[model samples]
Target: MSMGTKQAALDGVGRCSRSRPQRQSGVALLATLILVLALTLILGNIFYRHQIDVSQATGSLHGDQAMLLAISAESWARDLLASDNDDPEVDHFGEDWAQAIPLLPVDGGTIVGCLVDLESRVNINNFSSYTDTSLRAERSANANNMGLVKLWENLLQNMGFVVDESRVSVIVDWLDKGDELIGPAGAEQSDYSGFNPPRFPANTYIADTAELAAMAGYSLAEVQRLMPLMSALPGPTTININSAPEPVLMALSGDLGIDFVDMVLDNRPFLTLQEFYQAIDIRLMVGEPALAIRWPAKLIDVKSDFFQLNLEVTLGQSRLEVKSIMQRGESGRPAVIRREITVVPAGVTTVPSRSIDTDDENAADFSGSGRDRFSDPDEYDREYYLRPICEIADSYTTGDLDDSGEQF
Candidate 1:
C-alpha cells in the first residue's frame, strides 16, 4: 500500500516541474522580441537624424565653394589690371563697365567689376590739414580747396565759415599732420572744453570715415549729399580725374564752361601731370585753337597699386560676402603686394543709386538697371583705408592716423 502511493506522488511532481519550465521559456521569447523591436526603432530614429545633418553639411559646403568662386573672379580681374601696363578703362571683353564674369560650376551668381578714380572724391580724412594753409599749399598749388573737395568746402562755406577758416581746413590739418597738434588759435583737446574727439587737435587722425559726421560743421543733409562723391583714403585731398564724373570735373574748376566740361567728360582720365595739362590745353570751344587752359594740375590723385573687390555668393543655405583688398608690391610694375578678405553679413551692401535725364518730363525711372554696386574708391573716406590696412597693411601699424603712403 505505501509503494503505490509514493509512485503516484512522484509522477505528479515531475509533470508540474516540466509545465513550469515550458511557461518560463515562452515568457523569455516574448521579452526578446519586444527588446529587438525597441532597438530597431531607436536605430531608425538615429539614422534619420544623421541623414538630415549630412544634407545640411553638404549644402553648407556648396555655399562655401560658391563664395570661393566669387572671390576668384575678383582675383582674376586684379590680375588683368596688373598685366595691363598702361592701358586704362579695364579694356574688357566688352565696353560695359560692369562686365559679367559668367557663372560656373561652383559659382552661385554672376560677378562683375569696374575701376573708379580713387582721387575723384574729397579726402575727408585731411579736413584738419586742408584747413592749415601752410600744410596744404606744400602739396600743390591746385591743392587749394576745389573740385569735389571744394564743393564740400563751398557747402560749409555757404553755411557760414570763411573760405580759409572753414572747418574743412581743420579736418585737413588733422589728417595731414602726423603730429597731433592743434594750430595756434585752433581746436584741440585743450580748447575742446569738454567734448570727446575734441574740436581742436585731438592728436590723432580719423579712424573711421563715419566719424566725419560728428565733426562740428557738417550737416547730416549736406554730408549725405557730398559723402557719396567723396572718400577718406590713404590718398588725401585728390580725386583721380581719370575716374571722375563729368559733374566732378566741372566742379574742380574755378571757372567752368560747357565746352570745357564736355571736353573733360569726353576723355576718360588725366592722371599724369602732362596728361591733365594737355587735356586742359586742347580747348573744346569751336573758335579756339588748342590754346593753353588757365589752370595747371598741381596734385596727382593715385589709386595706387592697390584695389578692393567686393564679392557676394549664395549656395544652397549658405550665403557669404567678401570685401577683398589687394596691394601692388615690390616684385614688379604691378605685382600682387598683399591680399586681404573681409566677410560681413550677407545682403548688406552700399550699392549706389542711378538716374538718367531725358527730354520727356514723364520719363520712367528705368535706370534701376543702371545702379552700380561696385564702390568707387572715391566713395570711401581716407579713414576707410584703415580697415583694409588693419587687415592688409603688414609692416604697418594700426596706430597710424593717416596713410600718407597712398597720397595723390
Candidate 2:
C-alpha cells in the first residue's frame, strides 16, 4: 500500500507542475498579441498626424511662393514703366508696357502681367468741387465741371443706361462744397439722410470708383457698369486719346460717331496730338454742330501718367493676383501708389490674355464675359493698400492753384 500510494502522488505532482507552465505560456502569448496591437494603433495615429502636417506645410510653402512671384512681377512692371521714353504725353496700347507679359516660368511657377492706362477712362473725381477750390467759395459755371458732366452723360447713354439728366446733377451736388441743391434733381445731405441707412453724401472727392454705388438713385448694377469706364483719382486728369476706349472717344463729342471712334482706335499710337487730329477728318465731325462748337481738345491728351498693373502668378495648386497703381514722377520713374494682392484656389485662372482690339463688338459686353473688373475687398491680401478719402481730398486741397484760385 505505501509503495503504490507514493508513486501515484509523485506522478500527480509532476503533471501539475508541467500543466502550470503550459498555462503560463498561453497567458504570455495573449499578452504579446495585445502589445503588438497597441503598438500598431499608436504608430498608425502618429503616421496620420505626420501626413496632415506634411500637407499643411506644403500648402503654406506654395502660398508663400505664389506671393513672392506676384511681388516680383509687379516690380518688373514698374521697371518697364520707368524705362519708358521721357515723353509723358502718349500712353497707347501699342506701347510695350501695354503688351501682356508672356507666361514666364519661374521656380515651380508661372507669372503674367499687364498694364492699363487709368487716364484712358474718365475720372469721376473731376466733378468733385473739392478739387476746384473756387466752388468752395461760391457755385458758378465751371468749364471743367460742365465738360465732365457732358462726358458722364454721354458715357451712360452709350452704355445703354437711360438715366435722367438730373442724376448727373445729383452726383455733382454731392461733390460740390455748397450745401445748396444744384437743381431740381440735385441731392444734398438731407436727401441722403432720408435713406434707410441714413448715409451722408461724401461732399468730397471719391476715393474709389465703388463709392459711386452710394449714389442715392443708382443701383449697384448700374454703378458697376460705369466702373469699367470711370476712375476716381485725386484730381482732374485729361483723357489719354491713345488709350481711350471707343465709348469714351465717342463721348468726347456728339459728332464723333462710332465710325470716328473706331477710326481713332484702329489707327492708334498717334505720336502727337497733331498726328491724332491729322488722322481724323474734322469735316465729318462737323455733322454734329455741337462737336465743332465743343471740341474737347483741352479735356483730352495723348499721354498718361497714372497706370494700373495687374499681375498673376501660379505655383503648384496655389494662385495669386496683384494689382498696383503706379504714377510717373518728374524723375521719369514710376512710383507705386497702391498695391493689392489676392489668393485664388487651385484650378482657377486669374490673369486673362490682353485684348488689344477694342473694336470687338463683344469687348465691352461685361455680361457673361466671365471677367470681373472689380476686385473684391475680401479677397485682398493682408498687405492691400487703399487711399483714404480724406487723404485724397487733402492732396487736392494742397495742390498748385490755378489763376482762377482752383486746385490744379
Candidate 3:
C-alpha cells in the first residue's frame, strides 16, 4: 500500500510478463522450422514420383512410334514387288518406300518407317553368284552391261551429281569379283570414315539399295538417284530395253551396231522388243549384221506375283519392329506374316497376320499403288520373257520403262 511497495510490485509484474512472452516466442520458432522441413519432404517425394511417371510415359510413346513405322515399311515393300507395270514409275520416293513419322487413320497414331524393296533386295543366298565366271561370266559379258551402267550413270549425272568412279569400280569389284583382297583404304576400325563411324571395306554383299551406303564412294545422294533404276537381282547381265532409258540405249548403240537408242526412247513400252529392234538403223553400220548372234538371257523382264517386306517402325513412347514378309500370291493379293518385336511396357498389341479373316484381309491397313521388280528362273531358261504388266498407277510410274532392252 505504500509508495515504495507499489513501485516494487509494478517492476515484478513487468518482469513476469517479459519472461512469459519470450518463452512463447521460442516455441513458435521451433514449430515453424519443423513445419518447413515436413513441407520440403512432402514436396520432394511428389516431384520425384511425377518425374518417374513422365519418364515411363516417354519411353512408352517412343516404343509405339517405332512399331507403327515398321508395319508401314512392310506394306510399302509388298507394293514394290506386286507387279512389273510400266505406269506409276517408282522414280519419286526412290523405291516406293518412305520413312519418318506418318499418321495412320485407324489408331490415329504417328509412326516412323523404313520401307524396303524385296525385289531390288539381294538374296544373301546369291552373295557369291557374281564370282562365277563360267556360270555368270559369259552371260555378264554378253549382256548389255554398258547400257545398264549408262542408264544408272545418267540418272546420277542428270541429277547434277558427280561420283567417284574408282571407288565405284571397287563396289562393282566387290559385288562381282570372286576373289577377295584387303579393300582399298584398309585401316583399323578406329581409322575408317563415313559419318562419325569409321567404315571400311564393305565386304558383305548388298541385298538392297539401302546397303549402298556401305559401299565406298557411294554416297546416300548417289544411291538415291540409282535406286529406282537398278536392282539387286539375279545377276543376269543385260537390262530390259523395255525398262531401260535413252542414255542406256545410246551406250548400247555405241558398243554394238544397234543405233536404236532414239527409236527405243522415241517409242517405248513396245508390245514386243523385236518390233523395236526391227526399227534399228541396220544399214547405218556397214558391218554385216549378225543375224544368228544369239544373246544370252542375262536379263528377264519380270513382275513378281509374290513379295516380302521388312519394316522398322517407331512411335511415340512405344516401339514396334516388324520383319514382315508379305507374299503377293496369285492376282497380287498380299498375305502378310509379320514378325513383330514390340517395345512398349503396357500398350496393347495387335498382330493380325497370324489369322485369316474377312476383316483381317488388311487389318494392318497397308497401302498399294504400283509395283515392279526383277525375276530369274532358278535354272537358266532359254525362253526370253520381256513384257511389262498393265500400268496400274496413274501418278507415280511410266509406261515406257527403259534405256536398255533385255535382249537374250
Model 3: how far is 50 from its true place, Å? 2.7
Assess the local accuracy of residue 381 in candidate 2 as a C-alpha lDDT between 0 and 100: 43
Which ranges of candidate 1 are over 4 A from the true structure?
A: 1-52, 83-110, 125-164, 176-186, 190-208, 219-224, 235-238, 257-259, 268-275, 282-296, 300-306, 333-408
Using all chains and alpha carbons, the TM-scores for the candidates as numbered come to 0.55, 0.71, 0.47
* Candidate 2: tens digits of C-alpha lDDT, residues 1-408: 799999999999999998999999999999999999999999999999999999889889999878877777777777777746445666776667867678799878888666777888888877664333433322344332325666777667666666675657667877778677766777788777766556677888877887776676665556654555678777778888777765576666454455566567567778876666656645444333343234456577788888888777788878777778888888788888888878777775423332343323322432221113233444334221223222322233223422222222
Model 3 / residue 393 / CA error / Å: 13
Question: Which candidate, 2 or 3, has the higher TM-score?
Answer: 2
Over 189-265, each residue of candidate 1 has an lDDT whose tens digit, in order, gives 44343544334444455534555554444433344334434555543344455544434444454444335555655
lDDT of 3 by residue, 1-408 (tens): 999999999999999998998999999999999999999999999999999999988776656555545655555555554555212222222233322224443343444333333343223223334332333343345444332333344344533456333333444554543334323422223333432334454444554555655544455434533444444533333344444433334444534433455555555544444444444435333322331132212332222222334333434445454545454445554667435363544464444222343322331222111110112233234322211111111111233323343211
Which residue pairs come into collision in candidate 2? Answer: 89-303, 90-303
Q: How far off is residue 404 in model 1, in Å?
A: 34
Our model 1 lands, by Cα RMSD against the true structure, at: 12.1
- The window of 10 residues in a row where model 3 has the poorest summed lDDT is 386-395
